[model samples]
Target: MKATLILVGTELLSGGMIDTNSLYMAEELNKYGIEIGSKITVKDKIEDIINAITYGKENSDLIIMSGGLGPTIDDITKEAIAKYLNKKLVVDQDELNELKEKFRERNLKFIEINTKEVEKPEGSVTFKNGAGMAPAVYIDGIVCFPGVPIELYDMFPKFLKWYSEEKKLKSDEILIKDLITYGIAESLLDNKISDIFTEEGIDYEFLVKDFGIIIRLQSKISNKNIVEKIVEKIYNRVGDNIFGEDSDRLEKLIIKSLKEKGKTLSVAESCTGGLLSDSFVNVSGASEVFMEGIVTYSNDAKIKRLGVKKETLEKFGAVSEETAREMVLGLKTDVGISVTGIAGPLGGTKEKPVGLVYMGIRNGNEVEVEKKVFKGSRRKVRERAVLHSLFCLNKMLKRK
Candidate 1:
């Protein structure tokens, strides 16, 4: 099967907002052996939307649209689709009542503009939105979802299941595995396991993502023995770099390790701000293992908060191994991690250039410090520094 994604929003064209719903839909549909023929992003104009729909229908078997399904006046996506399909727009009474009740529960006034969320093209199948007031619709091989990510995420799966069953679409019996690795270059990783994918029905690909390298192995025959042998060989070649498998996040793994060992963690940040702590708190149940996080961006704050000595900051200039060690040692937790770096387009010296970082990890009486010089923009440097800090913490946890 083939499909085209129609993403409608003026913000997307103007670079005010990014379109992530199309990427999510594409990935989900690919799992069922569906090919995406094209992705079209149009503005909030009715003429542009109709043109996109006309183009999508000509090139693909199905059209999936997202955006312009809101209470605002610019939301004319349904009207355009109705005009293209020659159908009248009618409001579903049940959905309208439910939407009103939702507003009442929140003690907000329900206005007439909100009625647009319940309106759909004639003879279309409507699906309830669990995350918001909007209802998704399907008519004449075209599906429409709300622009919000959470609403689309909640409704797309249900719609896919119903549509798949209604059309008797069978999923491909494909076996896939993802081995995630960090702290290694992609070229070197490919070189290490280049010769392992010679067997029939076994395919492999490498994706260099922001987190790390993903070695994806797929088997068309669904043969367990062949897949296992290939995986074992790859592991033997570069096992030390592999951290987790499919859908495994670094922060989640670190939290799991701390819980398993009955240990607590604390973080002291400099260049990364609160991003290092924010990553941990984003995971569920992290409160059990996370004690506190302190951001000491200035030298005075470092001296007062993490107890870094004034003399140490003056000597090492805040982004050095000595300052990092002192920061981690002052945390007083079962496990302490500290990050100090110059993630900058400015404030770089001849001795300490931009993207130069020092990470310190303290486990009981032992303390280890690492110095690294990364390359990238300011945001990229900060993000990479956070990941490296977690990697160092994971290694320290493994030792004990």
Candidate 2:
């Protein structure tokens, strides 16, 4: 089914904020096999909002409108929908009492703002306000929701069932799995896997980037069983190199890998400066596999913590392959991963250029070190170093 998205905010139109809500909704709708035909943004004006709804009704099977649903004078989404549908705005007694009750329970003063929230367009279905004061409104195939991220997240997912019941949206089946890979461009992965898709006739897509790759697959069919079978068939073929599945990041994958393999990890960071450690520890169960992390940004700290040789720092500087190797191997953890680099606008000589990075991984008695030169701004350089460290560590983890 075709859909339209209308975002209302002067701030968004003037580039004061990015319109990420539309981006998120578009992708979510696509997963339901519902194509978005048009998207537009307007100021918090009644006529503009009404015109957008009018246009959407004429063109699309469904329309989703966000913003202008807050409890303020500028909150006009409900009013605009009422005008477009030629309906009266009447207070729903149930919702009005709810607002007052919540205020009373919290010992806060209630105002006309509470009454304003219950003013629904005539003959509109008011979806419950689990996440916010602004209740969702559904009228004539149009679903309007609040702009708040938390509220939208809670409310929009329920739209799947709502649409299926109300609009008779077909439950088209698609099973998707993602594998995150690095050290490759989107074009290159497409080159490697494009031929497979052609020969097998199994639909697949690649989300490629300098950060990493996420290979996704979904059957262009309506049967859940058949769609899932193709996903399994494809996964078996792309096995070990598939570090992550279903958009899980390197940290989550590593944690799972370590947990399954009964191994543990540690980090020694210089240029990456504990980013690697943070990535792992962010996951809920990472403590099961993450032993510790050491941020040795200085040469003296590296020597003291990871036992890098004082002479190595004097001869090759802090950002060198030799130093990285020493740092990784010298770590007391079972698996020691390290990164050292010149993430810089300054601090580079002719011999040691900016964006020069060295990464090291130590497993048992073996130490592997690799060096590369990245070109970017200071922050960009740091980001690249952190990404590369994760990528390399991911590969090594798989090999073990």
Candidate 3:
């Protein structure tokens, strides 16, 4: 079943707060065979909440609304839901008793605002909040949750389990192995694998990174034993370009390579800034193999910090194969990765249009440099550069 997520908060709309809740919810829901159809952030207005909730109910089978379940005047999620369901704001005696017990456990008295939290919409099911005082409400198709992420995270699973069972969805997926290939365009890859996906009644997802692509095959099936047979058939067709299977990020594979080789890594980033470092560090055990990361954005920093040659910068500009090679050569560490690129909505000349990237990797005495023109926005260019850098490093690591 498809679900809609609505995040309500004036803080989120005004950029006073970051909405991390929706991102986490979307990924988790996808794993449970529930697709996230729509996600939006609305203000704390009661009318806005009611309108959003009503609209979600009509289009989506399940609506997961976050924020605005507090006792403050701005906390209008509960009231808006009550108004939409045409139900009264009746005080829940069981919830009131629980509130009193909680306050007593804390050696405190129950206040009026806290009493307001006990007022859930009539005929609504309350998912008890183990973490906080505010309870989440589930009335028919709609599940309105507390704005606090900690409380919402704890309550979310309980509701999902209940809803998934009611909807009779099996949490099983067909697995297929992908053959990874480099130096192949997406259009070409699709032309090759499109027939296989259709013949097997399977779903395919591709993640393009650095200089390689990861193709994933998934199918929803009743029998678990059929996964091996289907995977073998796909491998027979496109086994040359496949890397690893089942959503393995390139950074993760790079980390595994470093661990296997017993080697350390350092990075010198120019146009990509610290984005590449951030990606590597996001891995759980990065500290084990990743030694250092430098964001030498300016030529002066590149010369002073990474010891890039002045003559190379002058001869080959900041974004050049010479400069990228020098950035690696200047590295004090044994193994290094370098990315020099122009990620631009601006600052690109006719000769050097936007999205020109040079990624280089040093795996011993041998160093390899890849020069490519990526096409995308500034964020996409940076992301693509990082992916390519990791891919190059992964290949070099394998040769070692």
Per-candidate TM-score against the hidden true structure: 0.92, 0.86, 0.74
- After superposing candidate 3 on the true structure, give the runs of residues whose Cα lies further than 4 Å from its correct spot: 1-27, 34-63, 70-75, 84-87, 90-119, 122-134, 146-154, 162-170, 173-186, 200-218, 221-243
RMSD to the native, candidate 2?
3.3
Q: Over the stretch 1-400, how does candidate 1's per-residue lDDT look in tens digits?
A: 7899999999999999998898799767856656789999999999999999999899988899999999899998999999999999998788889999988988999999999988899999999888988889999989999999999999999998898888787666556778999998989998889888898777789988887889998765458678888889989999888888988878999999999999899999999999999999999999999999999999999999988999998887899999999999989789988999999989888899999999998888889998998899999999999988888778777888
Please rank every candidate by TM-score, starting with the best.
Answer: 1, 2, 3
Q: What's the lDDT for residue 221 in model 1? A: 41
What is the TM-score (0 to 1) of candidate 2?
Answer: 0.86
What are the per-residue Cα lDDT tens digits for candidate 3 across 1-400? 7788999999998979998798678656766778778887889998888788877887888899999887789888888888888889988787899988888988987888888776878898888889888788888788888878888889988887887787776655433444456656878878876665554555677756553676755556553346566567666766645555655667888888888888788999998889889988999999998998999999999899988889989988999999899898877666788999899989899888899999879987889999988899998899888877877787777777
Candidate 2 stretches with Cα past 4 Å from truth are 100-110, 114-118, 168-172, 177-179, 193-205, 209-211, 222-242
Please, what are the lDDT tens digits per residue for candidate 2 over residues 1-400? 8899999888888888787788778667766778789998999899999899889999999889998887788889889998888899988788888878877987889887767777888888877778777788888888898887778877887876777766666556444546666676667666655655642434567766455677866555544465466556555655444556665777677678788888778889998877778878888998887999899998889988888999999998899989999989877766768999988878888888999989997766767897888889987787787777776677777777
Q: What is the C-alpha RMSD of each candidate to the true structure, in Å?
A: 2.3, 3.3, 5.1
Full ranking by lDDT: 1, 3, 2
lDDT for model 3, please. Answer: 0.81
Clash pairs, candidate 3, are 67-147, 179-241, 179-242, 180-241, 180-242, 180-243, 181-241, 210-387, 210-388, 211-388
* Clashes found in each candidate (C-alpha, N, C closer than 3 A): 0, 1, 10
Query: Comparing 1 and 3 by lDDT, which wins?
Result: 1
